[model samples]
Target chain A: MIKHLAAASLLLTTACLAIGPAAAADPGFTDTEILIGDVEPLTGPPALLGVAASIGHKIAIAEANAAGGINGRKIKYVLEDDGYVTARTIQGVKKVIDVDKVFAMLGISGSGQSIAVMPVLEKSGIPTVIDVAPVKFLWEPARKNVFVVGQSYEEGIVHLVNFLADKNPGRKWGLITQDDDYGITVRDGFDTVVKAKKLNVVYSGNYKKGQQDFSSDMLQLKDAGAEVFLAGGIIGENIAMMKELEKLGIKPVTGIFWPGRIEPVLKLMGPAGDGIYAVDYVEPFAGAAGKAFLEKAKPLVSEAEFKGINRYTMTGYAAAKVLIAAIERCGKQPTWACTISELEKTKNVETGVMAPISFGPGVRFSNQKLQIMQADTATLSFKPVD
Target chain B: MQYLVQLLISGLAIGAIYGLIAMGFAVIYKSTGLVNFAQGEMTMITAYIAWTISTTVSGNVFVVAAGAILAAVLLGLIIERLVMRPMLGEPVFATVMVTIGLAVILRSAINFIWDAYPHGLDIGIGRGIVHLGSIGVRTGQIAVIVTLLLLLTAIWAFFRYSKVGVAMRAVAADDRTALLMGISATRVHALAWAASSVIAGIGGVFFALSYDLSPAMFQLGLKAFPATILGGLDAVLGSGLGGLLIGITENLAGGYLGSGMKEVAGFAMIIVVLMVRPFGIFGERDIERV
Candidate 1:
C-alpha cells in the first residue's frame, strides 16, 4: 500500500512540472491585462524626445483602454529609461524581458540604443515594433519577430534630395550630418541622389553626436558657396546651424531631417526656422488628419501632454495601434508568437497619421512613403509644401 | 582671408566662453588648492538658475546676469560651509572625492528639476550681424568677448591689488603659516568658492545665451578644463586667455581639417603643452627642500 501511494505522488509531481513550463511560456497575460514594455532615453541629450515618445505610447494605451481594450484585455505599458545609453538599454531590455516577463516591447529609442538591444529582444522572442529608429540596421536582414515602421532616414533623404535637386537646378548642395550610422545613411542617400542627378556636391561635414556649435561649419559652407544646404542634424543642431548661418550672414536654402519638425524646433528656431524644408512619413499634428487625431487625443491626455504631441507622438501612436491590431487579431490568447505572425501579415494598415503600414512574409519594414513639408515659423507649424 | 577672418571672430567668441568657465576653475584651484571636478556641474546648475531667473524675473541681460551671479555666490557659500568646510583637515583625496560626489548630486538634481529640456535664453544680445569691414560678426559674439575682457580686468585687479586677495594667496601657499599670520584660511576658502561661483554664474548665462541653456551646458565647463590646464591652473587670470587659445585652435583645426578635428585639437594641445611645460604655460613650479 505504501508503494502504491509513492507511485501516485511521483506521477502528480511530473504532471505539475510539465504544466508550469506551458503556463509561463506565454507569460505577462492575465484575464484582463496584457503587459507591454518600452525602452526610452527619458534622460540625456535625447531626453525630451524620449519623453515625447513615451507620451505618445501613453495616449495610445489610454485610448485603447478607453474603448474597452483589445479583446477585453487592457495594455499595461512598462517604460524603462535607458538615458540614451546602449548598455543601460541592454540591461533594461533584459530586465523587462526576464524580470517583468512582458508579452512584447513596443517603441524603442534612438538608432544606437535600439540596435544594441536587437539580439536580446530577438533571442527572448519578444514581439518588438521598431517605432522611432527606422534606420536600416534595425530592419535589414529583418528578425522574425521585429516589425519596423516609417521610412528609413536614407529613404527620406533620397526622396527629399532628389525632389529638391529637380526643383532647384544647378544648385550647389552642402550637407552636414552627424558622424554615426544614421549620418552614414544620410550620406549614402545624398551620394546616391547626387550621383544620379549629377548634382554639384560642394561641401559635406560630419559632427559628433550632441555637438551644438556650427559656426565653423557654416563658414566652410559659405566659403564653398553652397546655395542650398541640408542641415541633417537633430532639432537643437538644426536651430544652432540656422543661428550660425544667420551670424555669418550666410542665408541658404536650409533643409532639415524629419526629426527636426517638432514644436520645440519651431519654437526654438523662431524666425530662423522659416522656409526650411523637412521630410517625414507622419503628417504634422497641425494638419487636417493630424487635427482630427489631436481632437481625439485632447480628451484622452492632459493639456501639457497634448501640447507635447508632435511627429514622434504620431509615429508612436501608429506603432502602438499596429501592435494593438495584431493583438486584437490574436483574440483572447494574445501570445507573442501570435502577435508576431499577425503583424507580419498586416498590409496597408492606416492610422490616419503616418503613411499606410504594410508587412508580409520576408518583409518587415512598414511605411516607406515620405511627405515633404515646409516650416511656417510665422504660424509656428508645418505645412505641406506644394 | 575673408573666411579666416570670419573663423577668427567666431573662434574668439567661443573662446571667450571657455575662458570665463576656466576662470572659475582657476579661482577655486588658486585659493582652495583643490581641483574642483564639480566645476562643470556648478556651471550647469547655475545656467539653469539663470534660465529660471531670466524667464521669471527679467529678460534684461543685466538683471538675469545679476540674479544668476548672486544665486551662484550663495550656492558656493552653502556648499563650502556644509560640505567643503567639514573636510577642511581631511586628506586631499577624500575632499576631492567629496567634490566628485557633489558633482553627481548636483547633476542628478539638475536632471530631476529640468529633465534636460532645452530652453532658449531669449534674453540675449541680439543675433544681428555686426559687420566689421568684410567680416560679419554677430552682436552676441561681441558681447561675449567684451564680457570676458571686462571680467578678466576686474578679476586681475582684485587678485593683484586687494588685501583679501593677498591673504587668500598666502593661505593657498601655506595655510598653516597664513593662519599664524592672522589670515583666516577658512575665510579665504569660502571667499574663493564664492568668487569662483560668481565667474561660473556669468559663464553659465553667456554660454546659455550663446546657445541654449540645458543640463548639457555642463560639457562647456569640462571643455574649459583644457583651458585651465593649458593656462596655469593656479594662474586664475591667465586661464581665460588659455580658454580663448584652445577655442581658437579648435575652430582653426575644424576649419582647416574637419569637424572631427575640432574636439581633438584642444585635448591634443593640452597633451603637447603639458609634455613641455608641466606647470602649464604660466603655472608656478614649487621647489621642495631636500
Candidate 2:
C-alpha cells in the first residue's frame, strides 16, 4: 500500500510539471478578456495628440472585437492621463502595472514620459508599443519587450536635410530651434548631414520652449546672411517663427519637420506658410488610406473626435493593428511571452495607414522612410514634393 | 545701421505690449496690495475670447476687440467679487497664494475650452512691412506702439484727474481711512480689477495679432513681471516705460550677443536697477518707524 501511494504521488507531480510549461498564466488575461493599458497626455497642451491617439486605438480595438477578438478573448483597453509630465507618467505606469495588472501597453505619448516609464516596463517584461513620440533614446539600445512605431524626429530631419541639399545644393543654412530634447535631436540630424555633405551652415540659435518672440532669433539669422533656414520647432513655435520671419522680411527657404504639416499650422501661418517644406513619414488625411481611416473611424467615434484626427492618428491606428496582429499570431493560450515573440517576428505588416512595418530580434523602429512635402498656399494643404 | 534700427523698432513694439500687461499687474497690486499672478492667464483667456468673437460674431477687428474687452471687464468684476473679495483682510501671503491658485485654475479652464492649438487672429495686422527709410517696420508693430502710447496717456489722465480714480488712490493709501472718508474700498477694488482687465484684453488682442493665439502666450505675462518690478508695482505709467526699456535691452543683447541673452539681459537690468533703487525707478519709498 505504501509503494502504491508513492508511485501515485510521483505520477501527479509529473503531470503538474507538464501542465506548467504548456499552460502559462497571465495577470490580466482571463478566459473571456485580455486587458491592455495606455499612458498618455490626455489633459495638457499635447492633449490633442493623446485624444486623437485614444480615438485611433479605440477604433482599431473596437473593429477587432467586432470581427471576433483574438483567440476568443476580447480586449479591454484602459488609459491613464499623464498630462505630458514625466512624474505623472511614472505614477500612471505604476498604477497600470501594479493595480490594473494589464498584460501590455499601447499608445505611450511624449518622449520624456516614455523615458520615465522605461524602467518599470523593462522590469515587468510587458509588451509595449510606443505610437507617439518616436524619440531615438527609446529604441536605440533596443529593450526586450518594447517596439516603436513611426519615424524619429532625428531620422525625419536627416531625410529632410538630404532632400534639401539634393534640391538646393550649397545654400547657406541656419537653424532656429527650441532649447529642448526635440530641438537637439533635429539639430543633431542637421549637423550630421551638413558635415557629411559639406553644406554651408551660417548660424544656429535656440530659444526657450514656449517662447513667443522670434524677432531676435530671426534678426540674428537674417544678419548671418542665411539663405535657407531650418525651423526646429513644433506647431505654435513654427507659426510664430514664420510670422516673425515675415515681419522681419527675411524670406529664407524655410524647412520644417513633421509637426509643422498639420492643418492648424497652415491655417495659423495663412499665406505665409506658403512655399515652406516639411519632412513627413505619414500621409495627410486627404490620402486614400487616410480617408478610409476616417470613414471607418467615423462610425466608431464621435464626430468631434473624428474631426480632431491628425497625422498622429495614423500611427496610433497602425500600432493597434500591430498589437492585434501579434496577439492573433499567438494562436491559442496567448501569454506575454507569446505576444512578444510574435511581435519580434512580425514582418512587412500593412495597416493601410502608413508604410509597411517590420521588426526582428534586437531591432525596433518599424518605419524609417520619410517623404518631402511642400505647403500649397492655394489649398492650405501639404502635397508631396516631387 | 538698418539691422540695429529694425531690432530697436521690433523690441519697442514688443515692449509696448509688455508695458500694457505690466500696467495690468501694477493697477491690481497698487489697489489691493496683492500680487495677481493670474494676470498673464487673464490676457491669454481674453485673447481667446477675442478670437472667438472674431470668428463667431463679426470679422471686423474693432468690434471683436470691443466685445472681448467688455467680456473681460465682466470677468474681472465677477472674479474680484467672487474669488478675491472673500479673501479680504486675510494675510497678504495667503491672498497672494490664492491668486496663484486662481492662475492655475484659469489656465486649466482655458486649456479645457480651447484645447491647446494655435489659432490665427487675422486682425489685418502684421501682414505688410513698411520701410521707414532704411529700417523696415511691420504694420502690426506700428499699431502696437501707437495703441500703447494712446492707452497709456488715457490711463494717466484718468488716474490723475478723475474723481473715481482719486477714490481708488485713497483706498490704496489706506483702505480703512478711505472708508472713513466716504470712499467705498470694495467699489475701488472692483474698479481697479475692471480697468486692469480691459488693459490686459487690449494687450491680448495686439499680442494675438502679432503672434498666433495660444495658451502659452500667458508666459508673456511672466516676462512682463520684470518690467512691473523695474517701473514700480504701484506706478502705472512707470511700468509701461520700464517695459519698453526691458524690451529694448533684451533685443539689443540678443542681436549683439545671441538669442539666449535676451532673457538674461532683461533680468540683469532688473537686478542692477533694484540694487541701486530697491523701490524701483518710480516706486514710493516707505519710511517705517521703529
Candidate 3:
C-alpha cells in the first residue's frame, strides 16, 4: 500500500512537469538557462557573411550575460549552420524549435533561410529578429512575430542615388544588374530616382547571379557610352565587373551593393581601386560607435573573427540588444506571447551602430536606415560621408 | 553594320572558350565513348593551378604558362591512374556517373584550396585596344582568338601525323578490334584523358586571363555542353566552330534581342540544327547492324 502511494505521487509530479509550472515563477527563477537559437550559413559561398553575423550575436549575448545577465537571468544561444540551403534551414529551425525549445531566435542570416524558418516560427509563436533580410515584404504582412533589422535594398539604393546626384553631377548613368528579384528591386529603385531627377540612363544590362564572365556585357555598356555606373549584383559578379573594367581601362564611378570587404578588390585591382567607392551600412571598426562595440564584443567572439566582421555583425549585435530588452519587458517569467507584445511597444531604442528601432503597431522594420559610410583609401578605413 | 561587326568579333572570342571545352569533350567521347562531366571542373582546377604557379613563381608569363600546362598534363596522368583506370569495364551509365562524382570532388577540393572569392590573373597580356575604325577589339580578345587557332591546328596535326594518335583513333573506332590488333585500349584511354586535361589547362589559363576565376567557372561546362551537341560529339574541328557560332549568336541575341533571349537563342539554334542535321553539322551518322 505504501509503495502504490509513492508511485501515484511520482506520476502526478511528472504530469505537472510536462504541463509547465502552474504559475509564472519570479522573473528569471524557473529555468536553468534562457535558451535562444540562431541559424547562420557557416559553410558555402556566403559563409563569411553568416560567420561574422553569428559572432556578433554571440559577443552581444556574452556581454549581456557578463553584466549579471538580462533581468539577472543568463542568456544562452544555440547556433546551427544552415549552409545557405533552404532545406537545411527548415531542419535547423525544426531542431531549434522542437528539440532545443529556445525561448526565442535572435539572428538568422539569409533572406531565403529566414523565409524557410517562417512556418515553424509562426507555428511555435517564436519571436524572431532577422539580421540580413532587407525586403520590406519580408516583414510586411503583419506576421505578428517577425522583425527585420536591416534596411531594404531599395531604400539603400535610393540613398545611394541621391548621394551620387549630389556628388557627381552630369554623369551619364548605366546599371549592371543581376537577373533576379533582388537585382530588379535595386534597378527599380534607381529607375524611380532617374525619372524623378531626370537623370540620363544611357545603358542597362542584366546577367544571371552566379555568372563568371562579363566581357560582352561590359563591352556593350562601354560602347553605349555610359559614364556613372550602378551595379546591383552579389560579390562575385561585382569582382568580375571590376576586373573587366580594369582590363578595358574604363573608369566609371561605381555604386555597388554589399560586396563584403575591400581586401579582395584591392588584391585584384591593385592601385586601380583608387577613387572607387562602395557604401556600407556598418562602419568597419571605425568611428566611436564601431570601436566601442568592438572593444566590448572582442572578448566574446573568436579573436580570428574580430578583424573581418562587417555591417552584418552590427545587425546581429543590434538584434541581440533588442531581444534582451524585449525579454526584460516581460518582467519575471516571460511567455512567447507576452515577450512579443512587449517588443511591439518598443520605440527608438538606440543600438549604437544602426538607426534607432521602433516596433509599434504596423512598423516591423526595426531600424530606419543607418548612415552610409564611404571607404577612405587614405586611412584604408571607412568613415561616414556627408 | 558596325554594331554587327562588333558583335561578331565579341561573339567569336566567347565562343573560342566554348570550342576548347567542346573539343575536350569531343576528344574524350571519340576515344572512350563517354562524356567527361568533369570537363569544366578540369578547366577550373587547371586554371587555379596556373593562377597559383603564376603568382608564386614570379617568372615571365610565357614560362609560367608553359609550366602550368606541363603540370596539368602530369596531373591528368595521375587522375587517370587513380580514378578512371579502375572503371574501364564499367557500364556507360556508371562511367558517366563516376565522372559526375569526380567533378563534384574536384570542385569542392578547389573551393577548399581557394575560398569562393573570384580571382583574376595578370598575365601581362597588354591592355591596349585595337580599333577597326568603326569597330573595337581588346588585345585580350585577340589573344583568345589566336590561342584558339593555334590549339585547333596543333590538335589537327597531332591526330593526322602522330603514331600514338593513330593508335588512339584505332581504339576509338573499335576497342575490341583494337585489342585484337595488339594495341592496349587502356593505354589509348589514358592518353585521351591526359590530352583532354591539357586542353582543359590551356583553356583554363586563357579563360582566367579573359574573364575571371571562381567556383562558378565550372558553369562553363554547361555552356559548352550545347557546343558539343551542336558540333557533333565526335567532331573535334566542329567543336571549335560550334563554340564560335554559339558564342557569336549568344552575343548578338543579348545585344539585339534581349538578355533573357540569349539562352533561348542558344537552345533554339541547337534545336534547329538537330532537326535538320541529326548527326550534327560534322558528326558521323551511326548505322545500327541488323
What is candidate 2's lDDT per residue for A1-386, written digit by digit as tens? 99999999999999988897555566777889888899887775687788778777888888888988878889889999887889998999989988999888997978878987899889989988998889888898999999998888878898988888888887898987778888889889998898899999888998878777878888888889999889988888888888777766668988999866777788788677898999887876656766788888888878777777787777788899998899888876777899898999889998887888899988877864688888887776778875
> What DockQ does candidate 2 have relative to the true complex?
0.62
Please give, for residues A133-223, the per-residue lDDT of candidate 1 as tens digits: 7888888898999988888888889888977887889999899988888788888998999889899989989998767677888888988
Candidate models: Cα lDDT each: 0.84, 0.85, 0.76
Each candidate's DockQ: 0.59, 0.62, 0.29
Task: Specify the CAPRI tier of model 3.
Answer: acceptable
Highest DockQ scorer: 2
Better of 1 and 3 by DockQ: 1
Candidate 3 chain A TM-score vs. reference chain A: 0.88
lDDT of 2: 0.85
True contacts kept of each: 0.54, 0.68, 0.21
What TM-score, over all chains together, does every model reach?
0.94, 0.94, 0.85
TM-score of chain B of 1: 0.96
On a 0 to 100 scale, what is the lDDT of residue B191 in model 1? 95
Model 2: residues >4 Å from true position, as ranges?
A1-24, A30-32, A71-73, B124-128
Cα error of candidate 3 at position A85, Å: 3.5
Model 1 stretches with alpha carbons more than 4 Å out = A1-22
* Residue pairs whose backbone atoms clash in candidate 3: A27-A332
